[model samples]
Target chain A: MASPQTKRQKSSKDVPYELIYWPGLPGRGEHIRLALEEAGAEYSDTAFSGDSAVQTVLGYISDTNLGDALNPPVLAPPILKHGELIINQTPNILLYLGQRLGLVGDKADEDAVFKVNELTLSALDGLSNEPHDCHHPIATGSYYEDQMDEAKKKSSDYIKNRLPKFLGYFERVLKGEASKSEWLYGSQLTYADLVLFQCVDGVKHAFPKAVARMGKSGDYENVFKLYRAVQERPNIKAYLASERRQKYGMGIYRHYPELDEE
Target chain B: MASPQTKRQKSSKDVPYELIYWPGLPGRGEHIRLALEEAGAEYSDTAFSGDSAVQTVLGYISDTNLGDALNPPVLAPPILKHGELIINQTPNILLYLGQRLGLVGDKADEDAVFKVNELTLSALDGLSNEPHDCHHPIATGSYYEDQMDEAKKKSSDYIKNRLPKFLGYFERVLKGEASKSEWLYGSQLTYADLVLFQCVDGVKHAFPKAVARMGKSGDYENVFKLYRAVQERPNIKAYLASERRQKYGMGIYRHYPELDEE
Candidate 1:
């Protein structure tokens, strides 16, 4: 079996895409990083730089320093700057990169692009955002420790209900005719598959027991297979082993023993 | 100023787009509805029909009945079925409709489409999903009354932080070169502007006192002006007056009075 990395065409542009995200934890930036790594695209992530670089990420979001001209000042980091275009929002940045990097399908099939986008957005909604809320149920401004009691309840509901639903949905998508073997979309690797891989990886870190149980239950067979397939890809495998891959911490998918279920 | 609706090119497809959502309230569906109405496109909403129609909407979501063949089973309502494509996410549906109905910019400028999509997704994140969470702080499965104490805390943080951050972001977007006048992107009307209008409308219903204060503070002048401009559009104005327009209730944006700040 040939690695999917061998098939990806290098980005025609020589411009190295600049990704500005918080240092340390993977957070939402992992999704974009996965795509760039898988495609062997030229990019420089600011997260690896020192604390001063993190300040550069914060500068874009701060109201006082937003300068006089920039429209739609970003509220958070994981901001992508490619030449003149500066954009935030993980899924939006992915959509733009998916198109530019040819991570989306053939240019002529416009509908397929939308379908891939739909899948990516849905995965983000359930896997990333909801999981983040599990640790901070009451407020984003407050710490997880401040809302641990509420987090426990929210995590219970999520582990029982949403986790299965989302995982099952992706499993079915894999089983569909559109995804012949391992890809989430029609017959080829798209950015959405990378997103799903990161989401599952994060969920596993967050709720080891629950995810382990789901794995043993033999329910989402295709989903697990898809995760392994992405993991085995040459570029991705190398990236995972390298120091560039950030570890899971107090980010979106935190491992709080109290929040997990058997 | 002439209403932007007059310039909208109707969807070429003869098929009346079917919108499936919860019966009573205009939640995420309103974003899609606003686009269809502004373009004068043909659409049939399942919410207006009988109980049997609601059952049909429920069937797509029910796991046991989703059948074996369907991939990526939708977890919730507000599903759009047009021809063969069945997509759920609010921003995804709007993206599809925006392209088909010519609500997005020139089809040739692909980057513009993504930019418009970025804006729409950001608005949904800040306005729709966040507001919904305010009333359901602990869990979506639970009711507002069950989480009243938590809801109060969440709503206070939202009013003080997230609401202004989002509204101010849009106001800045409007003040930019991209939006010379009424629209959020470019000089013409796009689906994103309609989405912004609905979001502002929803936040107002969910937190009247806070929104009123924001209005009086003259902070989000461009945002309020964009809302009014969308409201005054001939087709949108008529739709707002018509029976077809669903009122806000216990949906994404709800008025509990207790959740509002003076």
Candidate 2:
């Protein structure tokens, strides 16, 4: 394991990356944050800044908030601004950062890049988005309490069917020869590992009982091992303990006792 | 507008792209199909290839049925197999094809590729995924009729909020200086435009009345215009007219007349 000091030294310059997202909840921004931390990249987040930072985040999405002519308008936050480029979409941001931070793989291996992206997208589809939907099964705009009945049904279906399916898929991937035992792809840790770790963490928070049941079932041994491996990485371990690691709240992976089953 | 003959001439090989997706309905697969068709790339779809093809598709994801050691396992279809690389996820497949088919932009313009990818991801997030939830609000495994009450509520929220929010965002993007009065990015047609076209078409089919109202309101003129422009493209027009184009039937964008409002 690389020391935190050595990891920080590998990062170029000081605070080149600017992440504009809503403060408080770990949300989707945590996926990007984990990657940055794992790479020991020097970046600043608006979540730590004051209330006005929220406006700055909203400004990019607003039709009226025109700043740089070259910078394209984004639809939502978890927007990454580096130099003149401003872009959104969590997976897209990760792709860019993975390449820039040399976290993906060798630049020459385009096939490996696409494979890592495939893993990232699948994780987001199953773990992040589907889990979010379990609570807000009807509409994201509406309160989860308002759709409690529907959420209960969704959560049950998720725990029984979807959760195992996603976890099992990753477990298989980790067991594959490509994983090489330590990472999701190849020999080194890629951004996809960080993403999968965050996703698993989010699921654990959202459906503790379901995850615990799965853990006891012993179906996803590789998946749990991969999760532990990501957690124990020196830089990631430091970041997780630090105040910089925001606690999970009313974001993509919200914990509701009713939404979980033992 | 390039003739179908001219467009077909540009393709590298004879149907090297194999799209593995569910048969019958045009779901997320339509997004990938639109790109292949518009580019006049020769591609064969497993949907029409018979029952055994379904097994072949499932073989990639099934742990016991692993055929290729090199090909990474995929969770779901809309999986593309070209040469040795087999990959899934619509946006990821499109990103790969966009670069290979010269549908994105100049190879040197790395920034444009990311920007186009951003647009593609945003469309899938709002138009594709959200619209699918309108019918299966509670559980995706269950039928829409089983959750009719919840579907009605979800559909109403989608019509009132999500539909316009997404269409309007694209409208703004189309009106941006980079669009140049023709496409979503720059003066050329990218896969993002094809995706936007397919999404609008799906919305129109699913929520005719709501789309009619938005069309009559005269807000998303640019969106409507881009939709029309893509439909008029020579190769795409031919593809739309051909028997190869599958109709929307109980898929992502289902037409439940009760869900639409005038």
Strongest candidate by lDDT: 2
- Model 2, residue B163: distance off in Å is 0.6
Give lDDT: candidate 2, residue A65: 44
Q: What tens digits encode model 2's per-residue C-alpha lDDT throughout B1-262?
A: 6557445534423448989988888899998999999888888898888777767767766865322445457878889988667788899999889988888864554578888999999998899889998998877888888998999989999989888888888877876765664788876899999999999999999999889889889899988988999999999999999877899998899999988884
**Top model by TM-score, which number?**
2
TM-score of each: 0.91, 0.92
| Tens digit per residue, CA lDDT, model 2, A49-83 | 98787887877788764334444578888999876
Off by over 4 Å in 2: A1-15, A66-68, A106-108, B1-15, B63-67
The worst-scoring run of ten residues by lDDT in candidate 1 chain B lies at: B3-12
For B134-161, candidate 1 gives per-residue lDDT tens digits of 9998878877788898889888999999
- Please give the range of 10 consecutive residues that has the lowest summed lDDT in model 2 chain A: A5-14
Q: DockQ of each model against the real complex?
A: 0.32, 0.33
What is the TM-score of model 1 when looking only at chain B?
0.91
